[model samples]
Target: MDYANKTGGSAQKKKSFAGNKAALIFFLLTVPTLLLYIVFFLLPLGMGAYYSMTDWDGFSLSYRFVGFKNYIDILQDNRFLHSVRFTFLYATIVVVLKLFIALVLAIFLSGKLKLRGFFRSVYFFPAVLSMITVGLIFNQIFYSVFPSIGQALGIDWLSRNILGNKSTAIYGIALTNIWHGIATPMVIFIAGLASVPKDLKEASLIDGATPLQRFFSVTIPFLIPMLTVNLVMAIKGTLTVFDYIVAMTDGGPAFATESMGFLIYKHGMAEMKFGYGTAEAIYVFVMIAIISFIQIKILNRKEAGQL
Candidate 1:
């Protein structure tokens, strides 16, 4: 009895020490990560807020602080307004198209497709490539190969110069972004589709329902959450579309394809209006926040069956 009691007590003490050691290690490990997050994300956010209230020209040490004037400029400026409008248009179109494509591809891929792994890799390949590289590749294809093909077919595809034409420039960027990003949603949708219980599907088939009915009534209802998540991601991606736009048209064709992100870059980096540009950034930040908030509320209500 004494030996057993001693062993039991010793084991308990050992476990206690081990648990304490593990907890301490975890706390230590998370501290640097927490600090890095605050430094990189929160610090810049706070600094941007400060700069938004000033007219710091980024060069002079004594630039005058102008309160709310930069925001006023953003509101009244025609180019800025145009950029914002164009960005929304681009974002909406790309998000819808990308989601549709992703859903379709995911359905097809989830089934017994041959060489599934190979095909998935192929579809996702463009996403891994650098935006600069993708931009260059698309530029050549749009400007050169497309025109050449047009000549062969006598279709005059080169006349509009898709990248240079105002009407089509944004769409061209959207197309490239879609190609580069479609894989991400495809992967997501595939996971969502997989999570769906097969028993539900089998039960639907036994009730003399058509395949289409099963998908519309049973499958789609469960997929709503996945759709919401994907929509948010696509919205975020569109709002921050920069490198691809910069590489393709440089927000050219008379500022036709200029997105808010590119506009921020132009002001801050190109024009050297650091604080004013930070003000624009804050506006963009607010826009993203508001949209995301609205989306979350709507989706949450839907999830609760209150929508």
Candidate 2:
């Protein structure tokens, strides 16, 4: 009995030592990543929050603490308010068009068709191009090519540059964004479609379900997770849009295209209202967090129900 107990104890010590070694290795591997995240992300975020409450001009070394005055002033700023409204409107238009068009293209491309691979490559190619380059290309198309075509066709409205008019400028930018943005979402939807259970599709067919019925009932349920991802990405990207505006409009036509991102850059960098701009940036962060949280909860609930 004593020898048996000794042997058992030796084996147990070996297992415990092996477990500890594995844990030590994991800790060592994670430490560098944790340090990097803290230094780069968390540290800057903390500094920004602190600076937002001060009255620091961008170039000034000395500044006074102003409490929430910057926040209060932002609420009363008409231009900022207008930009907020325009941004939300822009986001709505872009998100809807992107998802709808991408889904249609994805469904079409996923089917058995001649030259399917070629079409898929053509659709996804746009996603790999630089966004600013695409914007510049489309700017020329809207300004020159479109007007020429419209003149030839004798269409009065299109004969004019769409970006020159305040009413239609947002739509012009949205058209460019949709053309460039649909590629990623289309790829995601294609992947989701591929993952749908073949057996479920066959069952639906055997039960006399029409194509539309099968799509709505079988395919859509499998696509809910992908839809949520695309929605979140679309909303976040559009809300903080900057590059396209810079390339295409430069917030022109009397600041009609000024987005929150552009406003932040204008104040923080150009006008040197560092504190106020930081405050505005904080507000944007909060707004994004709240909206994204609500979206995730609703979508997760819907996904669960579908399951």
Candidate 3:
């Protein structure tokens, strides 16, 4: 009887020990990452929320709570509203132009052509350069080379720097963004093209479809996933574009190139209006979240419909 009882007790202990072992392994795997995320992302976000409710100029140690006054004031600020409008315009133009160019380049490079590898490398080379460096180089070209060329050719508009005009400064910045941003989507589309089934294209050709028809029907359908990814990334990156604009225009010609990001940096870091800046930052965060969510849903819905 004692041996029987001891055997049952030993079996129960083994099962309990096994459960503990599994729990420890799970905790070991997840706890470190969980703690890091809380420390780095969540904690700072909470503190930012707290700061946004106070009237804290960054230089002052003591601050008073001001409720939603900053938020109310920001809504009435014309400059901030203008920056919002400019940001949307710039992001839309850049995303559309960049994706279109990248898609074209990808299709071209995927075909049978001479020195294809070299051309692919050349196209992708700009992406590796720092945005600031790209912006500076373009700035010099716009300011000096283009003007001289235009003067020699007697072209009226190009005779002067476009960045000097408020009407054209944002367009110039958009052009710079497109120049540097195309390579990433190009690479992604190339991968998508390569993964497309050769048999399908052969079947389309057998069905007497033209090259254009095959491209639209076969290639584009296959590329939808990649397009979705690129769309979200492009929107997010273009909206937060600050460094390039700063390096190129410094939001010049009466703050014509100013994006929400630039405004946030100017108010928070440069002007020391920490509370107002934080409120603005929060507004930007919410805007980005809504935009991203909508894009993802639409793209995902399209993908589902296609399938």
Choose the strongest candidate by TM-score.
Answer: 3
lDDT of 2 by residue, 112-205 (tens): 9999999999999989998899999999999999999999999999899999898889999999999999999999999999999999999999
Steric overlap count per candidate = 0, 0, 0
Question: Model 1 residue 134 lDDT?
Answer: 93
Clashing pairs in 1: none
Evaluation by TM-score, superior candidate among 2 and 3: 3
- lDDT value, residue 108 of candidate 1: 88
Off by over 4 Å in 1: 1-30, 158-160, 300-307
- The predicted structure with the larger lDDT, 1 or 2, is 2
Q: What is the C-alpha RMSD of each candidate to the true structure, in Å?
A: 4.8, 4.3, 4.9
What are the TM-scores, per candidate, against the unseen true structure?
Answer: 0.87, 0.90, 0.91
Candidate 2 clashing pairs, residues 3+ apart or interchain: none
The runs of at least 3 residues in candidate 3 whose Cα sits more than 4 Å from the true structure, single-residue gaps closed, are 1-15
- The ten-residue window of minimal lDDT in model 3 covers 1-10
Which lDDT value does model 1 have at 92? 92
> After superposition, which runs of candidate 2 have C-alpha atoms over 4 Å from their true positions?
1-25
Ranking by lDDT: 2, 3, 1
Model 1 TM-score is 0.87
Instruction: Compose the digit string of candidate 1's lDDT tens values, residues 1-307.
Output: 3333445556786665666666688689899999999999999999999888888878887877788999998899999899899999999999999999999999888888789988888887777899888988898788888878778788875644699888988888899999988998899888888877899998989997897998897888778878988998999989888988878999998988889999998998889889989999999999999999999997898778822
